[model samples]
Target: MIAVCQFGGSNCDRDAVLALRHLGFEAERVWHADGLPAEADGVVLPGGFSYGDYLRAGAMAARAPILREVCDAAERGVPVLGICNGAQVGTETGLVPGAFTTNASARFRCEHVHLRVENAETPWTAGFEPGEVLTLPIAHGEGRFEIAEDTLADLDDDRVLFRYCNEAGAVTDAANPNGSVDGVAGLLGEHEHTAVLMPHPERATLPDLGGTDGRTILRGFASEAEG
Candidate 1:
């Protein structure tokens, strides 16, 4: 079963559960205070303004006691995916690198954007091919990714997972909706089994919603569990 972590302000918990079930996975929303289920095979930090985005997007929730269990599971190689606000929590908890800060536009951006697959080998991206473009929706005011120069260089060598890009798959400033450094949209964690992204993959998983490109992203969990 997959555990969808739900904090006080998380709005995407149900959406995440629905998306995962649609893809043939057993999933349930697990309240933050309830802690992780031992039966959980994977975990997802769905998007939303956890703790009302207090003290920064995810600072409060990152310090939640439940995350300690989440961190332990991650260290044991359990697949963990953090989307949007969840991505912020992941970084705040040191589950992932870099930070999602104020957008370059300094305003909330909510729309469809293209993301180019930078590395297709990781469990989170194995469904895609290098240079493949995916249409995903992003809605956030503080989604810019910031990392140090040396860290950026290391991420380059580690082969970061996703980057904002044009329809033609060109990484350009104009295509960057959040002004993330190097157009980074997603990144793998210290362990490849974990990842975080600012885009709403769960929102894009239903065909009726628009496109199902996001399904591939969620598939990463099942892939890792099976392996």
Candidate 2:
């Protein structure tokens, strides 16, 4: 079963559960205060305005008791997917490197974006091919990915999952939706199964919703579980 963490202000928890269920995984919304289930084979930190975006987008929720279980699950090599606000929590908790700060425009953005696959072998991108382009929705006020120069240089090639790009797969400043450094859109954490991305894969998972390109990413859970 996949546990989708639902914090106080998490607005996308249901969407995540539905998307996962559509893909044949047993998924359910697990309230943040309730702790994770022992049967959970994967954990999803869904998008939200946790704690009303107080202190920071995901700062408070990142410290909640349930997060410990999430961390332990990741340590055991279970898949942990963090989306949008959850991406902020992932970075805040050091589950991944870099910080997600205010957008370059310092304004909230909501739109579809193209991303080029950087590491097709990682579970998060296994459904895609190297250099392939995927269109996904993004909505956030602070989605910029900032990393120290040395840290950026030290990241393994496989650590990068996807980068913002044009429809044709060209990585350029013009294609950047929120001015993320290097146009990075997603990243793999210390373990290949753990990933965080500032895009709404669930929003793009259902064909009736207009697109299903995001199934490529969410399917990582099934891939990891089967492995």
Candidate 3:
């Protein structure tokens, strides 16, 4: 089973579970305090205003008691996928690199944006071809990815899961929705099994709710379940 964690303000936990179940996977919303189940083969930190964005988007949730268990699971090779607010939590918890701060516009962005698959080898992007373009929505005010130039330069290209891009798959500032550094929209941790992205794949998982361009990302859980 896949465990979709629910923080105090995690409105997306149910959406994540529903989307995963739509794809034929067993998913449940495990409350933050309730703890993750031993049967959970995968974990999801879905988008939301966790702790009402206290301190920062995900700072509070990062320090939650259950996060420790999540980290332990990740270290043990369990797959962990973080989205939007969860992406912020992932960075705060050191699951991935870089920081998600205010957008370049300093305002919330909510609309469809294009993304380029940067690393097709990762489980998160294995369904798409290299440089494939996907349309996903962004709804966040603090989605910019801030990283030191030196640190950004050292990031392995293979670890970059996705980058904002034009419809033709060109990485350009014009196509960047949140002004994330290097147009990064998603990134993998040391292992492909761990990753975070600011886009809400759950929102796009339903056939009629939004475009299904994100089903492949969520499908990663099924792969882990089989293992």
**Which portions of model 1 miss their true places by more than 4 Å?**
none
Looking at model 2, the pairs that clash are none
- Each model's lDDT comes to 0.91, 0.90, 0.89
Model 1 vs truth, CA RMSD: 1.0
lDDT of 2 at 105: 91
TM-score of each: 0.97, 0.97, 0.97
Task: Give the clash count for each candidate.
Answer: 0, 0, 0
Instruction: Please list the residue runs of candidate 3 whose C-alpha ends up more than 4 Å from where it truly belongs after superposition.
Output: none
The 10-residue segment of model 1 with minimum total lDDT is 151-160
TM-score attained by model 3: 0.97
* CA displacement after TM-score superposition, residue 164 of candidate 1 (Å): 0.2
- Model 2 per-residue lDDT tens digits across residues 136-198: 999999999999999999988689999999999999999988889999888989999889999
TM-score of candidate 1 against the unseen true structure: 0.97
Better of 1 and 3 by lDDT: 1
Give the TM-score comparing model 2 with the true structure, all chains together.
0.97
lDDT of 3 by residue, 40-141 (tens): 889999898999998989999999988899999999889999999999999999899889999998889999899999889878888999988999888899
